[model samples]
Target: MKTPPPSELVAEWPLPPLASLGSTVRAIGIQRELRRHLPWKMRGFLRVDGNQAVLHLPIEEKEAFSAASAKIATAIEEISAYPVLPSEVEDILGISSRERHKWMKQSRLKSAGTRTVKMRGRAKAVTFHVFDAQHIEDILDRDLPTIWRQEDAAMSAENRKRAAAKRRQTRTQARSQSGCAGSADDASGSKLEGWDVFAAEGLLRAPRK
Candidate 1:
């Protein structure tokens, strides 16, 4: 039940592909018959049960069913070009989730003010959200691997900076607690043997459990 805003007005109505029908002579013939009785003007739901085609009328009709159905047929014809629900954008644009989000945040995946739809399979409706189809096509045309790699590098760098800062804070606190200025006995320097080149960068050893 996707009711356009009142201000938007149901200036047009369209029909969806007969989802419940199989692609067969009997099925397609039945669909063709059902289309005849469809209330296509303002808004209506078309349901076909066996040979019966039921056109569920709108709550309130401002026009004749025949007039509405004519408008609906036109609208339904135009719907053939629209992309209602696109599966994994990765498939359409050849990008990953992180890359997609990165581009979206940068307004590269879709132009500014662009929208992508949110579709409901169970409800059989497409929400107002819709992405720029041209943007997606450009993304597919451009090589986004480099951009994705750059994003990964920046993320890694940020993580490294945070880790280093945490380490520096830990070291500073440990030194303060030890109450030692140039305490040659900096316990963290390394576990040393009496006569050893303690001068060298401490051994890269695994930490004890």
Candidate 2:
């Protein structure tokens, strides 16, 4: 068998520190975005090792490597400041979509801006709110999710109590009205029965001789 030549194309770059940010999902997002700039054949060439992103290609594909490298470098520079997508924010904060929307709408989780992107293989565009990365970091650092959950629980308990009290009040009022009606009926019946007996004994007439 003929000896194979050694490969001459290899490029390695460190992923942006903010890319991982203690969240595996965020790191995956970063990788996906970087891959978008690569050709289909080069897509599988990318790999993440610890903090570094490595790319390997055949020597004959040097041009593809250069383009991919440049794009990766640019992404590293800009990705740190990029507004966090909703899914990314949810993963970073360990919150659900409903919670994220609630917090954002209430101004607890501030929105950096809106992002409009066309869905892949679809003609229609979709828009969504994006959040500042630093703001999310601050929120995570402060452990806001736990605090907000506690607050929500307390509010829910208070609401339940109020509802129960209102229901009790309604029942009490209904019973009171029913009891009054029953008492009126009893009094009316007693009065009619007494008058009937008096008439039968001829009490309304003069004493018989």
What TM-score goes with each of the models?
A: 0.37, 0.77
In candidate 1, position 186 carries an lDDT of 72
Off by over 4 Å in 1: 1-88, 111-129, 180-209
lDDT tens digits, residue span 1-209, model 1? 99774432233332344321222333343344445544444223554444333444444653564565564465445433333123335555455666666766766665334334356565554433244444444555576656767887999999999999999999999989777654656764666574256545455555567
For candidate 2, the 10 contiguous residues with the lowest summed lDDT are 14-23
> Candidate 2 — what's its lDDT?
0.84
Please, what are the lDDT tens digits per residue for candidate 2 over residues 119-184?
999889999998888888999989999999999899999999999999999999999999999999
Model 2 ranges off by over 4 Å: 1-6, 120-124, 193-209
